[model samples]
Target: MDHGSSHDDEVLGKAFDLRLMRRLVRFLVPYRGLFSVCVLLILVLTGIQSGLPYISKIAIDRFLTLPWAIVTVESAPGSGAPIPLGDDRYLVEISSLSPELRKEWEISGVLSPTRYLFVEEDSDKEGIALEHPDLFAPIAGGYIASESALRSLSPSETLSLRSGAIAGLIRLSILFAIALIVRFVFGVSQVYLLQLTGQKVMYDMRREIFGHVLRLPLSYFDRAPVGRLVTRVTNDVAAINEMFTSMLVNLFRDAFLIFAVMGIMFHLEWRVALVILALFPLIVIAAFEFRRRARAAYREVRRQIARLNAYLQESISGMRIVQLFVQEVKANERFAKINIDKYKASMRQLLTFAVFRPLMSFLSSFAVAIVIWYGGLNVLRGSLSLGALTAFIQYVRMLFEPILELSQGYNILQGAMAAAERIFILLDEPEEDRGGGEAIEEVEGRIEFRNVWFAYNDEEWILKDVSFTVEPGERVAIVGPTGSGKTTIIRLLLRMYPLQKGEILLDGVPIERLDLGFLRSRMAVVLQDVFLFSGDIMDNIRLRAEIPEEEAIEAARFANADFVEDLPDGYRTEVKERGVTLSVGERQLLSFARAVAFKPEILVLDEATASIDSQTESLIQRSLTKIMEDRTSIVIAHRLSTIREADKIIVLHKGKVVEEGTHTELLARGGLYAALHRLQFAELGGGTDPAPPSPSFSEG
Candidate 1:
């Protein structure tokens, strides 16, 4: 299979895809209670936010300024007295007051009083005009007086008014403070809940995606780079996390804030509200333009970063080859190009945001200017109160804030949608096929391959019409030059890949008709390249398979890996990444011990001893006989000496089996095996005389 060229770098979809949204909502179902609480907090926080400006307006109009008060007086029979207006000012009719009372009134605080024709005494003629006409105006007969202009209040009345005004101011201040404190508390709670919910959802999504990636077939990994998958599980999921924590919750808050501001504005003055409404189309247009450009920029950024990461991973992994070939300059040039491309994409995204943010701010300022100009006119004409106009301006500013936030939120939403699309695409990949067949508790270790034909791609067969069989407890060896499908045979036997055109059977039952897990569990394979995970030596041997410590030690002893006991920590020695601290031969020996620990019925060794030293080879050869004592074994060998004593040997060339027999029989036949054996003998500086049998040269 070709191990290159991933096709996952597709452009993102729309910023608000319904299908994607529906799927995303499924993850929230399990945490609906937390989600609901967060939403409730959003609404409560919005209400508190909206009420603050209204409270300010009330404080301005009600407590900060004094309001006019009017007083009325009536005369009683036999009680002709003056009524006090303020500061001992009296309102006495000319006909009702006696001379004594009038003298008393003249001594009062009223200095110069204004008098008007109480009522026209003569029907056709006007009465004498008032001298202080500016202070008092005639209204419905008896002269009306303005205490604020003509008199001062008594000390008691003055104190009462001052006290009331102060009380009103204190009340308004308390309400304002309460609003602020409540808003702060609720805002904090809302943010905390939102982040908590977002984190939980992110955890679930990452878990599901990681699990799905693990279950995918090996073929998928051949083409998909590890970096890209890492991005999907880590970076891509984080983008969605930003959406849930910031965008999703704030979306509702912004909308509610805008609506609440609009409602208050319209209630205060619909005409002023209409002016603000006219600017909506402009904001909407700008938002749409921003969304379009931002989505493209973000999608390009994601793609570029993926490429950058893939290149870095490949370069780092192959750095050895790169340095060996003295191609560091070329490698750096390639990496630099990818890095520059990513920077350019990121800059484009930055530019998009930079333009939109300031543009929205300018538009918001423009809306505030319109409110001030138009509302200020109505306030001058006394049609709108000064406090109401002030509140309208505040509301207009509040309205645009959410709009600006919404535009930015759209950028986040676009990024999230892009991430979700990629994540879902990966989650949608098909898992390895778990065949619907009978599961077996045990197998007798008899294996057969019938008319096998296989290929990684198309009909360029790697294994062509190959047939072979090995009876129970038999040892078989497959010998072939490179590209002769020897390794493919072992892979097929383990059912790593599906058969394109043939049947493999275990104990007279077709392998494909056996449970995948159960069939694989019955055999153990030791590959040439030993992969050691970063862990202790004991864990590597047992692979967390619940093997008893004693069994593990015995397996190590059986494989002749006594070197493990000589380490400082023995089986507990720490293995670094890829087991770099251990030699290749040591790693291979650990693999042998791992295979023995599993204690399978069939053992398949594929070039297992190609890297061992002579001394280690001697120990491995002795262990091999013990390992294959009562088991069916298939040994794919490169060194002729390793498989000379095999019960049967199959020779293959160019995807076809050319011969099958014991080593001496094949050597006598003088076919491909004999030719290969003779070449090895020549390399060893020995003539065509059979070398004496030795345990060091046994099958590995």
Candidate 2:
């Protein structure tokens, strides 16, 4: 394994990749209806949030602030713009004038510099207005008094005269409260719907990735770590979920808020809106720098995290070996080194956020200051209402708020892009060659390997020019010394790995032409080490097939796995991971039972009884003759005595076939097989009883 491939898998992804996003979006297609509703809710929620500040502006300008201004209109224009009071005094709403119109009136010396409040002629306030007759000007149904003159009256008297303004303020207050409540309700709905959509999309992506992984050729697993593939299905897929929920949803919401805030600001006061809008370039520059640095920091953090997770998985899986070898200290040091690297990378990411957020904060404040400085001058000159100025300040803050969220959204996108790249790379690996192959219902199981050459890596051949044939219904045994490519023959026969040269044929049909799924269904392999899943004995025997319980029991009986009947649960006995609770001989029995349940035309045994005790060997020997009866069987044995009754035995030395004959014939020839037989029998004190071999063979 080129360890650099780990880093290569960790592609430093862009903050936004259009192609990757399009692929990610494919997951959402299934839930598009709900996704579209969520987007619509975001728009509706943004309008409500944006309107909240405008509600405050309405409360301030129309009801709270001084609401009347005296205008000298030269005896009232034909448009009836102002309500005439008397002697050139006309009352006009101060909040109604545009900045341009207000400037025209001020230049003509018609707009009043002082603010005023109107007193409607009602029983309570009329008497109070009468008391301030000197400052209050009589109108058609009320009196208008300058704000400065109202201060001269007693506090109780002023409050009495301004009761109408208080009433109007109460109504606007009620409206503002209602808007806030509506915003809260819709905000909650929007968030819930968005998160639910995100979860569904993640579910689809994970299922697809897992199914694709199962179809991948076994050779791919030889190059990729189990932990790496697990991370792709679990951690990497989850990161994409975060991106969908956090970044994609918020991208719409924050953009809508920013645009709505700007529109409201311009509607309230354009000059102040322009002042804040000008600062956006500065905001853009700061945010660009933040996103750039944050992407790099975030990429490094993700890479380190993946590395740490891979290391931790390996350590936990091999912890038993580490303790047995007293390498605990060394393992801890290696883990600490990786963990510290992760911590340092995390700190760099934190530092990036620490610096950028404050910088964005400074920009937000700078925009506020500009609004205050420029809009305040207009307020003083009587061209801009104080209500609009205050609203402008609120809108400026709202504008930068979206920019801040976008910075964080960009950060999520960076991680998501990298994760997505690794995931898609795995998905893009062509699924094993299951297509374009001929399908067959059955085969005679006359398997042949013709001029086969193979290697795990480049040019390191495990089998060189190997050719052998097992005729239909013939029991052929392959015997060899350790590391002599015995197991490789069985694996190649099953097409576990592709051959570099020559072809494998089943019933004279090239194995490659047969559909992979159909071809594998014809053979059953039982190895020395049996792997069991976390399930009951029945499931292990049938292997999740449609085989009935009766079939499983019959198969177990045929394989002489009778110990299962003695167990407390019998065929229903629960198997632990890898059947660690079962004895070695019992696991081998289960393997045989499972093979029988599959009902294959061919049986391949690779030292299936190589690690059994003498009593268990006698127990299994009785089943072997019955189980392999009338079947085309190919067996690899290290114990020479086990294959003595075999119809024919082929002996391999190194990567080549050295001798081929019956066991007695090979012994008479006194070749490599004969030497090995003599050596083994000598170790057993010349006894004919075949004991289990000391060495187990697996071609690497």
Candidate 3:
């Protein structure tokens, strides 16, 4: 098929790989005792389950022998009928034989349904063919009192070989009880074990996947979709749970039961059992072929489901954007196309299942029919007993159960395997590149990006040999047109992605040498889009920072966010979904305050005031200058007025530094920077000097 279909098959194929399955079994290694106990219990239960029908046959044979001449072969004088042996009747009997007829009977056999009960002594005295017959008299009497009285004949007067028949009813009742109890105990135990294992394993799987996802590089997430990853962590792992909990266990139990029952059948009569087993190869071949097709179909189904889940998630998350752009109809049509594809995949899988299950059922039924035909004739020819024939029928039916269970198990395994492939692919992704350098003991906040080249993909370079430097405790504004790789510089400097050609340095040390966590801890960034957690104002501001409450309020005041005091609950005030409860200006101010509360050595702002009104913008600028004092700062400025007082302004055009100087120096240069200034801020008609701009600084 196509690449996507092939990928699905690869995933589904993982379930059947002996090596992979063995590794997966390692998860149960800690609970080996429980697993061993469970396996032993299942085997015991399966054997017991299979043997019950044979026991029923013994009971039936005993009952049949109770009221007939167990042996009669000699002709009577006048009636021309066979003479019953011994003085007693109603017991299984042996008879004297003619030379020729007896030889034939000895060599082959003659068995019929005619009732012929004779009596014989328990000459062997082993007492296997006899019992006292008094112990169960009361029980038998309740059912047939007259028959019981006759059956309890005294040994001194006359004893019968069929004495075992007297307790036939009791024997059958005991066997049934034991069988039912075994079944009940095994069923309950299996459920408890399966559920317990499933729940524990599922919890661990989710935790592991989520933990790995968290440690992955941010660039990995930039390329991956949110919903697809969610599908793996949720739906894919859930599929594995379903298989492990139920399907895999049942497959083992059923297969074991079927084989054990077959062994017993062969023990009784290998010739007849072989005839019954002759049909198995055909069944297996058919099942294997069908399973292959079903697996392919189911893998397609899983792929469709993932695509659909991703589509649905994206559609809902961006519903407002879709509506604003009037693309609802287009989105709906796209959804419909994917939904139809999913439906088709499911139907194809269903079709495969529909064919496979019934085919297996039919093959099993045919095997049973063959057994009945041959087994019934064997009974007629005296090669088999009626009870044995009944047992064979039971055994034949039992064989089908495993086949059926295997079919279902294969279905689940195939689906799970497909899901697992996708999940494993994610888990196999390479982690962030921590360059082989010793960790930095400390950082001084002096920063430089020297001849760095980078790209998100191999197709085009987003940044090309771009270089810049900022002195310690200096504020620099990075101004550029949209898509000119302004954000990329910060990303590279932070080592979210490795630089292609050159290195970024901090405090005279290559950033690669620094501990990633320590580097991030010393730096703070507030993006154009403010992300507020689902908590009160104070919690969001602290955000695992653990700042003192008093310091938090002071920082808020510095970011012009003291508006919390005018609200009903100050810093404790709740922010609803994504901080919708707060105005955009308020959210931006809080983000700034959060940054200040961290007391970072360096601060970075990406058009943090881009969306706020000019009035709020003016208030934030005053707070911004106060926060920038004595700190190394990088401001990606969209509003020219906001960065007028920066110590240095670096104008970027298409990933290259086109100009660098104070605002006035850039205006005097009359280059690309001058053109951008005229286009962006000239309409304001502001003077060159804005309250004595911050003194410009340079790279050492």
Candidate 4:
């Protein structure tokens, strides 16, 4: 097949990548012993595969046909020493003659193509030969006849006369059967061992990649698509496994088989072997071209598969959003487009195979034809045995069979190389800096953010030179407008992102100096939108921590989450994905329960009660009063009424703290806090304002 049809067919160099392969070989280190066994099995299997044809050759030359040839050495001189027969004839053992000398004699008209079987005197078969005396001719110490003459005998007599040959054929059949059984046993063992090695390698790679991903900074995941990362863990790794199991194994087996076939062919008949090898250059060229095309096709196929998987993952995950917005049709169209792209890529790959398969078959047939045309004549002239010629045909087919498989190997190698490149790229990313600092067992809950400035993008500050302090056992409520960097402050306090300007300290020590795990373990945050894994309610509350079951129930009770006891399964009820079966208020209760179960020294609530109903909010408010009695609590809420009784209320407008006092004091001051309070007071139909009215946001 001509592989230049594809526009993306770049270069033959891409067909094999050495650098990538060298890196991939590191995974094979632990399994090198098993891999060596696979290679050794390849040699054994190839030898057995090459021997089957020769077995048929032996049956044909030694058992089915006559062994003696008539030589007319009286007139033309022949090379081999021949026994002189009466009447200017010579009895020649054709099997004993060298190929060249036998052909020379036959060409010189000394050797006759007519073969004869000689029956020894005093043997059991001699009785049958004597009865058919007309067909048998007298020889020195034996009786001889052409196979044509023996055919004139009766069936029972023929069977008796050829009983020795029948027994030999039976022995050869047993030998063939034994070879097949051994091949089957070893073949199964080889496949099992090879696949085992491949699976182990895959397991190691997946584990390493997953562990690495977990250690990477959250910023990397912020921009990276979840679906694409999933592909790295799954599809990409499987592609590399294909390389190991199918391509690598087949490469070793095919090379051994090709060389084995070649060596045996030359041994059987060198001249015919040369004729078959004359077409070797053509096979090489075709393979090289096919490799280039196959690499391009495989790359395209993998790319399309990644796109398809990514789109499907995203669409399924956002099916709720798609349906809510009535975008299901658009989603389906997009999915169909990606699906069609994968289909086209797969069709292109199939087309490459379809063309190459038949081309290899043609070359195989061409090779066979040359062998038959050349070897047939040599057989007739007594130079090549008919057995050897038949074996040559089988060997030619065996030689080209691997070429067909080699095409598939090319695709496997290309796909795996691409997957390896992606996987290595991900592995090369630096892990999150794990705060190479002190591991503190405990700390007083005193949080301070000093002159902090930050932004997700370059210098577009989300927080600008902000400073705040929360003393030990203090409840602080931060009230702000929607885009007032309230959530950004929480993220900075937790060290989810680095500070651009100033520093954050926890209990007088820089937050970055504290071990990351220890820092996070000491504090717990409950946000408005709660997240839950697929598990029972109790498991969700306790998570991976060694919290006692009774402690979890107590935490749930403290969060006013006793509603679970009213249900059929109670705390053991199965939580579907993200706790979808539970109501929003119930999920919030679970979140609060989880935070309380941790018994963190510091607690953060980011608009925790904003999304709940009034009844649930009242329950949460009562629970909050008890939970924050002695804990350091930071609350960011939009509902101004919720913070009226706080120990301190900080009013923030556009990343700056404009007012700092208790809620009553801020309302008395009549600043941004009083204006925001009045705006909410008018909207909620409250009776009157506590202080003199401040201008609303638009009026101010």
Score every model by TM-score.
0.83, 0.92, 0.83, 0.89
Error (Å) of candidate 3 at residue 460 is 4.0
- List the pairs of residues colliding in candidate 1: none
lDDT of 1 by residue, 584-623 (tens): 7788888889999998999999988766666566677788
Candidate 4: segments with Cα more than 4 A from true spot: 1-16, 71-82, 86-89, 97-111, 131-134, 458-460, 481-483, 650-661, 664-681, 685-700
List lDDT for all candidates, in order: 0.76, 0.81, 0.72, 0.81
The C-alpha RMSD in Å for every predicted model, in order, reads 10.0, 2.9, 7.7, 5.2
- Candidate 3 lDDT by residue in tens digits, 1-700: 1213223333445457665566557666766676676777778778778878877777765575334322333433122234333333122222233334433442343323443333234344324224543322222112111234444555543344444565676778887897889789887896787677777777777887898888888899887766568877888788888877777778778878877988988865566899978887888888788877877887778678767766776778788999999999998898899899999999998998888778877887887788788888776665556777888888888887788678768777866766666777787887665554455555568999888888888747888888889998999998877778888888887789877788888887888887787777789999878999887898888887568898988889888889988999888888889988778888899999999999999999887767777567777878888889999999987665656778899888777888899988988999877777666545556534232211111100
lDDT of 2: 0.81
lDDT of 2 by residue, 1-700 (tens): 1222357546775778899989988888889998898888888888877887777777777766787777887666333346787788778876566656666786576887677877778856677778768988777878778777888888778766667777887887788788778878887887898889888888888999999999999779988877788889888898899998888888888988888898888776677788788888989988888888887787788678768766776678878888999999988998898889889999998998899889888889888898889989877776666777888888888899898998778867777888898899999998898734887656787888899999988999999888888888888989887788888888888787888999888888888888888888888899888999888999999986699989989999999997999999988889987798999989999999999999989999998888888778877887877788889999886655558868889888787888899988988999987777776676666536655456332222
Model 2 regions more than 4 Å off: 1-5, 72-89, 95-100, 106-110, 120-124, 139-142, 152-160, 435-442, 456-461, 481-483, 613-615, 678-681, 686-692, 695-700
Compare candidates 3 and 4 on lDDT and give the better one.
4
Model 4 TM-score, all chains together:
0.89
Per-residue lDDT value at 191 in model 4: 91
